[model samples]
Target chain A: MKVTIDDVVLPGDFCEDIIKAGEKSRVILGPGLRKELEKIFITKAGVLRKRAPNTYWVDSYQKRYVPARGENVIGVVIQKAGDSFRVDVGGSCSATLSYLSFEGATKKNRPEVQVGDVIYAKMLVASKDMEPELVCVDSNGKKGRLGVLNDGFVFKCSINLVRKILNPSCPLLNSLKNEWPFELAAGMNGRIWIKANSMRETIAVGNAILGCEYLTSEEIKSMCTNIASILAGHVS
Target chain B: MTTKRPQLPKSVLEMKFMRKTRERIEKELENTQGHDSLYSNIITNEMRHATGNFISESSFIFCEDLLEGRLSYKGMNPEIERLMEQDIKTSDPDGEMQKDVSDEILYKKMEALNKKRKSNDTPNKNPVLKKKKKF
Candidate 1:
C-alpha cells in the first residue's frame, strides 16, 4: 500500500512509496522499517516519518532500552568485573565497559570508575546474542562530551520522551536553557541526569522536561516560561 | 583409446632447452585442473557476480542524527559548557554565520593592511633617523 509520511503504521503494512522513491536514488530505511525481497515492511507500530533526502524512520513509543550500536547511553556502574565494569543501562542485559576504553586509560593507569557512578558512554558493539560493549572515548581517542556524570539526579522516563527532548527541532531545551543555569544529560536508555546550582533549580529543570512530554511545541515553550517564573517565586 | 592431454603454449614450450620453464608450466596446468575438480561444486555462479552493496540491518540509532543530550546554560557546570563550546566549535569550525569572503575582498583587505603597516613603519623610522642625525 502507498502510505504517506506521518501516517500511523503497523506491522505487516507494506509501503510501496519507498520502492518508488528508491527507484530514483538510494533510500535509507531507518529503525522499524526493513527491506524484504522486493517490498518494504514495517516491523513496529508507529508513525512513519521521512526526513529530507530520502531518510525514513518510525517514531514509536517505547520504554525498554534495546541496545543499538553507536548510541550514547547513560549507565550506572553496577559491578567491577576483572577488566571491565558492568553497567546497568535500563536494558534487558547489562553492558560491559572495558577499563581501557576511557580517554588516556592504559594498562598501568586505569580509569577511576566506581560502582553507583553514572557514566554517559557510547555503544561500541551491540548484537542480539552477544553482550553489548561500551566505550567512553570516541574514534579520535578523545572523550568529547561523554564520560562519568557527577552529582546529578538521574531519573527514568519513556524513551519517546528522551527522543522528543533531544530532537534538534524540539523547543523544550531552547526555552529552558535561557531561563535557568542547569546541566542536563539525556541517555537514549530512558534515563536523564540533571544538575543545577541549587536543588530547587534542578527540580525545576526536571519538572519542566517531564511536563513537556505530551505538550506541543508552542505549548512546551509557554510551559517552560511558566515553570521558570514559578521557580523564581513570581506567580505571573 | 587413451585421452590426449592438453598442450601448453607453443611460444613457451619452444624456448631453448628451458627445463625449469617447461616443468613450471606443466605444474601450473596440473594445479589449475586440480582446483577445478576440488571445489567445482562449492563455487556458485551467483558468487562471481555479487554486488558490492550488501545491506546489513541494524537496530541502533545514530547519535549524530539527534541533538546532544547533554547541555548547560549560564555557568552551571562550567566543564560541561566548555565541552559544549568545544563541540560547537568543532562541528562548524568556520561558524554558522561565516561570511563568504571572495578572493577580491581578501586581496583588498591584505592590500589595506599592507598600506597601513607601511605608513606606520615609515613614520617610526623617520623619527629614529631624525634622532640619530641630531646626535
Candidate 2:
C-alpha cells in the first residue's frame, strides 16, 4: 500500500512522494527507507516522516542500535585489548576504541579507560565490512563532551524516545530543564546516561523522561509541572 | 567517469605556471593507461559500478538535526553547561547575523567566483586562458 507523510507504513509499502522526488534529484534514504532497481520501498513498520529538502525516513519504534558514522553514542568499555578497548554500544558487535583516539593520548601516556566504564563517544567508522570504531576526540583532538561518563546511571529506552527528547521542538527537555539541575547523555544506540545531585532528583528526572515517551507535548508540560511541584513540596 | 582522461588545453599546458601540474597529469594518465591495459581482462564492468547514487543513513540524528546528547542544564555540571552555552552561542542566529562581511558583499564576491568556475567547466569554449583582473 502507498503511504503518505505521517501515515503508518509497513514493509514493502512505498511512498509516492519519495519516488516522485527521487526522479528529480538525489534523495536521502534514511533508516527504514530502501532504494530498489526502479522504486523506493519501506523496510520497517513505522510512520513515514519527511524533513525539509528531501530527507525521508520511517520513524519506527526500535530498541536495537545499528551503528552509523558521525553519531554520538554512549557506550560501555567491555574489554581492554593490546592498544584499543572494546566498547559495546548495544549494537550487533562491539566497537573498537583506540587508546590514541582520546584527547592528549600518547604512546607513553595512555588514557585511563578501564573495563565496564561507561563512556560517551562518537562512532568514527561504522562500515558493514569492518568493525565499528569509536573515538573520544574530534578532528582537533578535543574531547568536546565525548569522554568517560562518570557517576551516571545508564538506562535503556527505545531509539525513537531518544530522538524525541533530543528534538529541538520537544517540550520534554525544555519543560523540565529549568525546573531542576541534572545532566543527561543520550546515545543514538538507545542508552541514556543520567546524573543528578540527589537520588530522588535523579529518579525523578529519569521517570519524567521515560514517562513522556508516549505523551503529547501539552501533556508532557503538565507532567513536568506536576513533577516540579511534587519535587518542590507544593504537591503530594 | 570515463577511463579516458581529458587533455588539458594546449594553452594551459604551455604556461610556465602549470608545468608541475602538467607533468603530474601526464604521469597520472600514463600510469593509469598502462594499468588499464594490464588489468583489462581481470576487471569487469560491474566493478566500476559498485558505488551507488543513494546514500543510506541508518541513524535519524543526521536527517533530524538533534542537539548534542551530553548536555547539562541550570549549572548541574558546570563544564558541560559551559560547552552547551558555547554551542548555543555559535549556533545563535544573532551571532550569525554579525558576520565578517554582509551577505550582499559575499554574494557579489561569489558571483565573480562563479564566473571563473564557469570558464573552467567549459574549457573547450575558449582556447586561450585570459588573466583575471584584480580590483
True interface contacts retained by model 1: 0.56
Residue lDDT tens for model 2, B1-135: 456666789898889999998899889869968998899898877666544546688878878989889989888889988988888888875753657998899999999999989978898545444533321
lDDT by residue (tens digit), candidate 1, B1-96? 167677667886878887788888779879977986798799766666543232333542541267787788888878778888888789887656
* Model 2 native-contact share: 0.84
What is the per-residue lDDT of model 1 for residues A35-149, given as tens digits with 9 covering 90 to 100? 7666788888999887777777788888888988888899999999999999999888999999999999999999999999999999999999999999999999999878999
Best by lDDT: 2
Over 4 Å off, model 2: A234-236, B1-53, B95-135
Which ten contiguous residues of candidate 1 chain A have the minimum total lDDT? Answer: A227-236
- Candidate 1 clashing pairs? none
lDDT for residue A62 in candidate 2, whole number 0-100: 90
